[model samples]
Target chain A: MKRIKSKTAIVAIVFSLAGPLSAGESLPIRNCTWCHGSSAQGFSTAPRLAGQREKYIENQLLSFSAHIRDNPLSQQYMWGATANLSPEAMRDFAAYFSSLPPKAANDGDPQLAAQGRAIYELGIAEANVAACLVCHGPNAEGIREIPRLGGLSHAYLKRRLEQWGQGFHAAAEPMPQITRALSPNEIDALASYLSFVAYESLE
Target chain B: MKVIGLRLALPAAVLALVLSAPSRADEMGGPGFSSQELRAKLDYCKTCHGLSGQGYRGYFPMPRLAGQQPKYLENQLRAFYERRRSNPVMANVAHALSPSMVAALAAHFKDLNTNPIGGAPKEPVALGKTIYELGLPEANIPACSACHGPEAKGQGEIPRLAGQLFPYTVKTLGNWSKERGQGPAKDDTSFIMAATTHNLTQAQVAAIAAYVGSLR
Candidate 1:
């Protein structure tokens, strides 16, 4: 009788636990990490999704999926994974990745930081480009449609600007025209400035 | 007095109607969208363009793809890829992608739902209303709806104007004033945008930008 009761109780507990298991329960990782890196921070020239806004990340991936946004330079590499992301998977993926804290920006050169700051706060007097701060918010947290540029990795920022110049529309927004006006020097300066600038507020 | 009128009008409501309409004739659809749809999985082009391979409106000059057929979207996608299309920026986007990916993308957006995102904003949207109704006579800019339609829903080649990434919208207009190829559309009709912005002072640009941002 004791053995029978113990076996029944074990079966009951196991079945109860099993029922609660959900397909969505996975972290959306554990696979694809070899190239994407364990932290989802990206490897080589691929992007770092760690701590990114899930909506934004998903939006980018969707662009890849839908082809609204593409990078010929990087196309062959990403399509393999981006293809499998269904709309549902995209949302779950975005939500999963966006929920985590982002990695900190790399420590940068102080001298370059000051130069980049001046350029960021005040555009080249000759180019007529407005200060990024005027539109992006004083703290670079971004507002509405513009993106937060500060504290992002320099590599990411540089690549994004290069893509923008190359006509890679984020598609989620309309900046290709604006990006068309960005000179390589301006892009470099902006990327450098944006990388080291700290976000002064979260709100 | 004009400021007072802006304070009274419901621009956000009007903007929603303008943004959620169908895409243009030679194109696809409007800025049809919803935050809920986007948040779901990010895989839906229908979240804005419409299901059944239709396109919708967003920004200026971008048209609807719904019912237009994926073949056309594929062609445009090809144009974007090769630069046969005049859009240098869109070309870069197309170029970065593979033909297969482009086909899939065109298929999705062409098949996504056509709806506005979470209703439109509840903001007063006053400034946008002014710009929509009245021309910047000082700058010789015409009423927005003349080509764009009421509240900027758009018609023919004109595009839906609400619910866009406001920064991109503002930047495109501003860039059109500065760059040659980066106008409102794939075609040269973007001359309209260059003309409208021709006389705009920085303050006018900022005002219109704020108003437009308040929309969708």
Candidate 2:
């Protein structure tokens, strides 16, 4: 694990580089922090990069680098700009970022989140959706290639669902078919569930 | 806005055409993914991924790997094992499967019929459709179909959000945006999400998540 001081030093090293951005190594913090945050804690809009699985991070980096995972809003400047970077750098950066810890989510509407939690645990019958626990796990923890949803951003959640509704499926596995059936109200309940509910476990 | 929806599927259609590959070495046109283990996993995965592995709909997001290429499946499985793909939660699950098992799972998924995952009859579905057609425009949010495709299927860079499981979508989105040291989904995608999330609200998100999950 990287100590805060060490991470600072690494950033310092990157800052100290007098030449152009290195392709063989990770992208300088400058390019990364715009969305990830200066400390890589991520902001209200994004999830934490620290304390994440390294290989997962690497794959996503590769997706962006390869243009396999593109965001209409973000890709224009972030991923598209970094596509030229070497694979080694992508891995190194993924390793470095994955090693960091996540920033905790701030206080939200616990009751509303709890209301959302009910839907997460058990799906609405009229909607015909499965319980969130069926695939995500009982505690909102995710399954293989599936991510957990606790302590995330209200704003971010909103956009993603819109993306899903409108049909943005950057995720590799099953998401392509998943968003097809969602309705706006359901998106709201789920988002509330995530924003307000505290996940049972982080691991 | 209507024009945008009309154009939504162009990318996904093109993607399907591009990914349509010739048969690989020694293998027939089916189950062309990584390994046989994946085929076995396919049976196990059907509970959530659907019989065809296309997934039930927005709430499932399990992915429809039925005819995906071996290289892509192999790389994805390996990436999950090595933690080079998607998010930590998936990486953990992917890692649990043995190499051959992952390959077999991929193979199984690749062999399934993706048609089941195809477009549902054009009707009013719910959350996904509402959001897709009309974003929180006041929030300055963009409709997802603009890039993702009208049917919620995806193109190159974009994935198909339809039929994705509720948990996968919720969790992955959280992982990408919920700050550092939070949970398993951390990584660079977090950055991409930051800018995108700027246009949304929590309640809206919850509704959409459920809507997407409801796809049968």
Candidate 3:
């Protein structure tokens, strides 16, 4: 009797550790967490989904399935992930991930942060670069369909910016044109600066 | 000897006229800008203002310059430059523009007639139309059509209200006194709107903004 009770308690602990999955026809969140990390904070090349704009994530999922976001990593990973998702599933995932609190990566070069801040705030007007704050919001919190940029990983942000200039993700308007104007050093500065920014600190 | 001097004087006079003609033209239009320079500048403007100058909704709503009166556009640019308008970005942009470049840009934008990028709430539209067409007599407001023309196309220094962005109009009307006529010198036109803006309630302003924004 004692052995049987211990066995039942162990099983219960294991089940609780796994957490409860959402009821209904939606895909298991583990399918995304395997690559996105258990916390949805992101891992490797996958970006942090937590605290991202819900509409932006939903739009990107649709873009992936449609083959519009054709960057190499997206093709290799997100395309398959989003391929068979229903509209409701997409909305559910977007709402779920975006609701999670985000932590700043804080992974940038301290020396270059000031230059990056200046570029982000005011832009290099002489070079015809429009200020990022005009579209990205003052604290980089994003609005409506725009994605939050403050706490995304440096590598991910850098890759995305570079991809725009490389002719991938051509459908994201104004970005292709905007990124084309940024030099490699400027891209580094921007990505580095953004990685270190804590969204809460600014708020 | 008189004939010899007359021949010398005639060539000198002709040469002087030929040399001064280009400079006089430059004086009239400010300085000459190459087509390439003008095109580049226009693209820069479009980055903030929409591609067709139709206006854009960024974190801040950029106003439509397309089909606007060149005089009004020029006056605003001058206002930005003179610190009469308190927009840091526009001040930076306006400061870089030569008078001829400003004229070229104004002319270029004035020719672009595009549809309004509409996104305002629909409920207030009818009320907006009424307010735009007929002023509230008890509130001492005059009909907007009186100055903006029946179609809101505006004349001289008055801006074209047709197809202006909803948020841009709202922000402009709400902050009229704070943002405009800010320089040491008085701006007569901006002053005229100050009393009118002060009198209208927030709802009335939204109605007018919505009505005008819906116009093509």
Candidates 1 and 3: which is better by DockQ? 3
| TM-score of each predicted structure versus truth | 0.43, 0.44, 0.85
DockQ of all candidates, in order? Answer: 0.02, 0.02, 0.17
Superposed model 3: Cα runs more than 4 Å off: A1-27, B1-32
Could you tell which candidate, 1 or 3, scores higher by lDDT? Answer: 3
Better of 2 and 3 by TM-score: 3
In order, the candidates keep a fraction of the true contacts of 0.00, 0.02, 0.37
lDDT digits (tens) for residues A51-70 of candidate 1 = 45655666677777776566
lDDT of 3 by residue, B129-156 (tens): 8878888878898889889989999888
Judged by lDDT against the true structure, how good is candidate 1?
0.51
| Prediction-by-prediction clash tally | 42, 101, 0
Error of 1 at B2 (Å): 43
Give me candidate 2's TM-score against the actual structure: 0.44
In model 2, the runs with Cα more than 4 Å from the true position are A1-27, A44-46, A170-173, A196-200, B1-47, B51-216
